[model samples]
Target: MPRWFNTAGPCRADHHYMLPALRRLPEVLPLIGQESYFVLHAPRQVGKTTALRALAEELTASGRYAALHVSCEEGEAAGDDFAEAQRAILSRIRRSAEIYLPAELHPPPFPPSPDISLLGTALAAWARVCPRPLVLFFDEIDALRGQSLLNVLRQLRSGYSDRPTAFPASVVLCGLRDVRDYKVTTDSRGHLGTSSPFNIKVESLTLRNFTRDEVEELYQQHTHDTGQVFLPEAIDRAFYWTQGQPWLVNALARQMVEKLVPDRGQALTAAHVDAAKEILLRRQDTHLDSLAERLREPRVRRILEPLLAGLALGEVPADDLRFVQDLGLVRLAPAGGLEVANPLYREVIPRVLANTAFASLPPQSITWLRADGRLDTERLMEAFLAFWRQHGQPLLGTAPYHEIAPHLVLMAFLHRVANGGGTLEREYAIGTGRMDLCLRHGPDTLALELKVWRDGEKDPLEDGLVQLDGYLAGLGLDSGWLVIFDRRTGQPPIAERTRAVAATTSTGRRVTVVRA
Candidate 1:
């Protein structure tokens, strides 16, 4: 059995690999047939390159079309110099065609240094001699900037009429954003006219995450190959945290099968999954780091702030919206809302951005509330109240996370106390307008709800207590804390006040309100 999963795709050894079969959508296969110029897009590491490469291989192997996959990423460092970028692309294709296709298949008829643009001549030439119709895949096509990308797309458009005969029959522009979002500048006017570049795309396909069942199926592959069975909850946790993002799903499974699980002694479990998540996030591996990088962009921040606050924005431009979605920073909610893409992202992105704010605090001291050395809910909240009173405002400002900074800081503090020293479970939903922190210490469990309240509004205590009480009762828990940050209070010193359990709901749930 192999020691690692193929996460990046295909049979490659250097990149982490996952099965190529899982990434391709059935809808894309038909589009490949119509000789259409389509777009395949997703955030980095979502397998755009891998899927296209595998698809190209699949199509070419069928002997139906002459499929070729070429990467535009190689020329990306050339910057906005469209000519240099075009040269890089043509040279790359010439080399790939020679290696992958028959030598007699005929190279593109363009002159080595043509007076005309290399893109048009190259496509025209490649079509003339091919024994069969051609399928062209321009991977990382978005890497081309300004006129270069526009030129390539427009050249393809001009040649579209010759498809299945004089030009490549089918073309795919693969990148992070859709071709339509491209703001190509032509003739120096910066106008998106009817005949502008990048206007000739048909199908737009996004490679989606593995479904819940697909995740289990992939894990079953590992188990069958290596005899490493994942505990049921391990699979559940994997789906919950990653939502089947290809790289993360494979990475988690790889680490579990290879390192986290004991040597054929213990099954993989949720506890292991939880710990592995922290390890992967803390390592700031390339995948996680890239996701974190998008948060720093101003456009990203504009879209994300309201998302974090559970407020909806009106009429966001399609480009900025797609940009964040492509980055995997947000996901489409089932009810037509936007949400953080996944649980791990929701948990870790803030920490990655807000590391400085959290780092400034002294390490928290965890005291087991029970004499039997288990999690102490009462004591934890006691610690949190004091912590919030003294350090909440400073932490909020310094925290790198722009959204949900206050709530996450409090959770970080609680995690430092509970998970850091004792045992606790953290649960949350993206874009759900609420944060749920559950701490389990031995037989006792603490469920805390955090919210921000507007100053002019009436005391949320009545509603807050009812909510917390019901949440606790549902779990058969007697006590819980509902902490509401008074936004009207601004950054003032903490109120250091607590509302005792003076009231009971009709269902008899106990609720304690804390304003710290």
Candidate 2:
């Protein structure tokens, strides 16, 4: 059977086009060799489970250790009940050991005890009787919560010194976060911030996304198997869109090969990859949906809100930034700042946030289209001005994020225009101090820059025009729009303030300045 790209679960060599899992996790072997307990963390679906499971099998096959990959996820349902959680975890470990380890290495049954804290004792007994030094990979360790989580970490820490002979040597705790970010509490009081119960963790290593070369190598597997080749430009486009995110890289390839263009005779081009990206964003597949659901989280909002609005992220807690990074919603930008992890996410974030507003919009006529079906720039601007006068304020409130309310409202209106087969692309980031929009309607391309005019600040028209000029230059256009949203106190109503005027940028580009 030919291997295919995998999106849903752990990648199996027999079924999926995959890279060497162990190569992605270089820190594991050295840590195991030194008999150290460590944490392996990364965003969901980035192959943490696959990597650890492969390591376990390889270690056991070497005949030097009894290694098993066990999950603590079942214990999540137990909540704060330490006894129930402990039982669920131990049962999972026993079942996993029976399947993955040799008969002689299978852990003996746990000693019957009422004390939930005896998990360490049970492990000690198993190690003492096992034929070899034991190595264990505990997956989903962060799924335990409240007292259950605290108890498990403390129990593991209690057995730290008894490794190799009395307890598992070189244990690994695997989850979406490092040990420092685990939420643990000793009593009914709120979270014990940053205080890890499992302080014995030697290091917290994160699994990184694939590099450009890795992305190409994985795609090449499909070509080698079935004779369907992805063109060089398509490969470059895929890397640019996904930033080597594993699931996204695979999903885009799957959508293009298996669904979009299944004919093996046709070469996949850059255009095919771009179309696949749009389909994935519109469909909001399980992975993207999971990411969208996290938008409601406070920490997620703290970073993403200002990011979308193109406002300065001032005074944000360091942990919040780190948390967002761990979730894979943002990354350290190559330009020395944080940005949405990839172009695909940059598009998804606003669309997901504007979904409600998109639905609430009244039906609009395509008055901006010329007789030849081309978009008329002036007519489009006039229509937007009229729409802003009528329903902009109300629609702004419909957005889930407040900082980007105006931006969302405008995007919702543009989405209505693009509904007729045009495309709207957005660009915003920290320190940008503005949001740039590019609308492509048939042969027409319009560039727009949006800036807010607050009470204490001067009018942003000069800066907006300058920025829009640069944006237009990049797109090889000679004209665009600079929209200044007057958000200052004591301003006239939106209807009264909304208007457009002709202006010229310092770079000699003609610009239509809209104030609303």
Candidate 3:
């Protein structure tokens, strides 16, 4: 009876609050009209399927083409068995046609022949008999791999000439990547050989996430439907956290409207959005969990290690960077270089990197909390010193990205602080040679800066003091912590060398410098 935000599957206008699918992907219909095949790609859960299905329905409804959307995902299980994959794909086409098209427009049953050519042959048979020109969309095209994928592509390439009558007038291959990237893992025996399959594609289009204005418009739908409103600040905070990520945009709103504050009488506020973020991050729902899982990938670590440590990137491969970008983990900043795509990802990445150390951390003692729940920074420092002396070295060894072991360990300890009723936020840029952290508990705020000392580098203390001073200036504080980790060879043992001393910045701000 009421529409809601959808996070799990394709959005339906009747049941879900959604923008016009065609508006997000306006290039599709014109491409189809030109009888051109193309590729549409974006990361998982970004509304790829919903846009394709919506366009297909509109085209079929217009009586211009017998449009049908089908998925090649079912063929993934066939692996190198291209014939089996072909059968699975063809079966789906017939089923989709029967359910969505009139009998006169539905595809005919498959021919007796079954092999790598079966997909091409079956589509040709359907096209020849259907009264209207057919347009097809093959969703999850990248899910097919090895020889199976190669054959599917080759068959499509083979069918390119017989169009508008002998075959579907237009074809779209939709997935998480450009088909050209598929060559990386494809079986060499049946190599795709330089765009032979999808080379007919005139263009490649990507569906973008909603803009801030789009997000506002989407939330306004709730106001129209139920007489409830999302306050302006709530809308702003939600966009800032999600960065217009489709699943996150819908998921965060769903969390507030469905679970956090179900009452339509109460106006949603920024606090509700913040609470929803904490729940989403803590629960590590399927979407976030899948994102965290990407951290284990070696390519991911290669990019993130230097990012966390605020050091320059090395000779990383372009394809690897593109692949990570395609996965929506990082984006090229307007100023250049790369950054984690959104603030939420920026937080999740480091926490996930440090999860191992957090697990092995000793149970937290309440000594770090003041009577009124404010953080006792001095007490927390004492606890950290004792903990670092005993466990920091071993915990450093457990860091998933070794280059930023110290950063991860410190984050792990701070995470323990956050769990005890507070929040810890991180900020760093490649080549900054330092990471800044902000910890808040009730009314108390603590700022921390981390630096690594190595064999050839100058003493980072002066630079760290300056950086920490600037950080303090931003938070309007007079004092904060600057931690320097000695990672050079032949250094004194960590337990023996660890200590904290007071220092001053060039600007006369006070700093507590810890050397380990």
Candidate 4:
């Protein structure tokens, strides 16, 4: 069968182009061999289940152990009902064992036990009767909630002593988060807080996104299969854009080959890769939508708001930071601070944050273009000034994120300007004190910097000019716009203050400074 990129569930070798699963997280096998209990965590759809399942099959096939993969997701429906959750989980284990194991290695029936301790007793019973040592990969273990999650972790810890004989030799809890972040809401017990319930775990590991070389290697599998080639620049573009996010890597290839250019004779180029990225962003596929959904979370908002506006991240909880990282929303940058995990996220965050305002907007009336269909920066500025004078205040209330409301409104308007034919790119970071934008519309490119002049603060016009001067330099442009939103008390209404004027920066750059 022809192999293809996989964007859905676990990658099956028979159906998908894939790298060796165990190779991604090499520590897994050694820990299993040491009879260690650990946590395997990564963002959703990053192949945690696929890797763990492949390892289990490999261990069983090697004749060293009887191993199985199962999910605790089914048990989620039982809520805090520990007995029901255990029954659901144990049933999955028995079913998997029957399918994946030889008859002798299959679990003996789950023994009767109390509701609270059923999982521990059941595992002990399975290990006692099976001829070979058992290894368990508990996927989506975080899905269990409240007392249910706490009970399961306790049960695993309780059975930690009798490895390879009375209990499973190794157990791995797999989920989108480490065990500590599974803050289940229960009536009796408060949050999980910093302490993980599964304290017996020796190590917590994560499946990493593919490296640049692996990205090329995986794409090479496609060329070898279809006799089509992904050009070198195209491969570089993929890595540059996705930064090796597994689902995105596959999804980009899948969308390009499957829809954009179906011909096997054509070589995919950087342009094709760029088109694929735009399509993925505009279509808002399941994986990207799931990520955007997290923007609604308060903890997620707390970190991202300042990051989006290019300001300091105020006092945030450590676990909240870890939680956001675990969700794959952000990562530590090469220069040493946090950044949105990749370019895809950087685009999605603002667009998703401004969704309500974007939807609330009526059709844009300004032509915003020359007769030749090229973007006119002057006309675009005029349109923004006119629109802000009339609709900006009302639209601010439409945005869900209060801290970055001005940022979201402008992004929403820019989304309209760059809607069909071009792209608007955003750049912001901690302590930058402004958000920078690069809008590409046909042959024209416009650079913009946004700053807020809040109450009790001096004007940001000078700071915005300096900041925008640096931004335009990076883009290698001679000119740009510096926008200072006057949000201070006793300022004139937005209609009265919204105006644009040209100014020169310290770097001798022509800047359109808009104080609105």
Compute each candidate's TM-score over C-alphas. 0.85, 0.96, 0.96, 0.97
What would the per-residue lDDT of candidate 2 be over residues 43-151, giving only the tens digit for each residue? 9889999998999999999999998999999999988999889989999989998888889999897877666666887898999999998888989988888889888
| Candidate number that wins on lDDT, 2 or 4 | 2
**Model 3 clashes, total count:** 0
Candidate 3 vs candidate 4: the lDDT winner is: 4
| lDDT (10s digit) by residue, model 1, range 1-516 | 264675544444233335655255787777877777888888777666667777777787788888888989776766567778888998888888778776666475565645336777777777787788889899888677676676677778888888878788888888777766554553322323333465567777788888888888877776766677888899999999998887888878777767777576568999888778867766777888877777766667778766665545556666677778876788887887677888888766656655665577776665645666766666665676667777776788875544567766776675565544444344444344455667765466778876667656776666666667667777788767777767665445564443233455556765566775
Q: Which residue pairs in candidate 3 have backbone atoms (N, alpha carbon, C) closer than 3 angstroms, thus clashing? A: none
Identify the runs in model 3 with alpha carbons over 4 angstroms from their true place.
183-196
Query: Where is the poorest 10-residue window by lDDT in model 1?
Result: 186-195
Point out the higher-scoring one by lDDT: 1 or 4: 4
- Cα deviation in Å at residue 497, candidate 2? 1.5
Which has the greatest lDDT?
2
Q: Order the numbered candidates by lDDT, best leading.
A: 2, 4, 3, 1
Q: What is the C-alpha RMSD of each candidate to the true structure, in Å?
A: 4.0, 2.0, 2.1, 1.7
User: Cα miss at 515, model 2 (Å)?
Assistant: 1.1
Error of 4 at 59 (Å): 0.5
What is the per-residue lDDT of model 3 for residues 151-172, given as tens digits with 9 covering 90 to 100? 8888887888999899889999
lDDT of 1 at 481: 77
- Per-candidate count of clashing residue pairs (backbone under 3 Å): 10, 0, 0, 0
Report the lDDT tens digits of candidate 4 across residue range 1-516.
Answer: 988899889999999999999888989888988999998899988888889889989999999999899988999999988899999999998888888889989877777888899889989998998888899999999888988888988888888998889999999989888888785884322457654567888998988899989999999999999988999999999988899999999999998899888999999999899899889888888899999888878778888888887778879988888889999999989898889999878888888888899998867775788888899888888889989999998999998888789888988999998885898988887777788889998878899998998877788888788888888888889999888887788978888888999999998999998887
Q: Quote model 1's TM-score.
A: 0.85
* lDDT of every model, 2 decimals: 0.70, 0.88, 0.86, 0.87
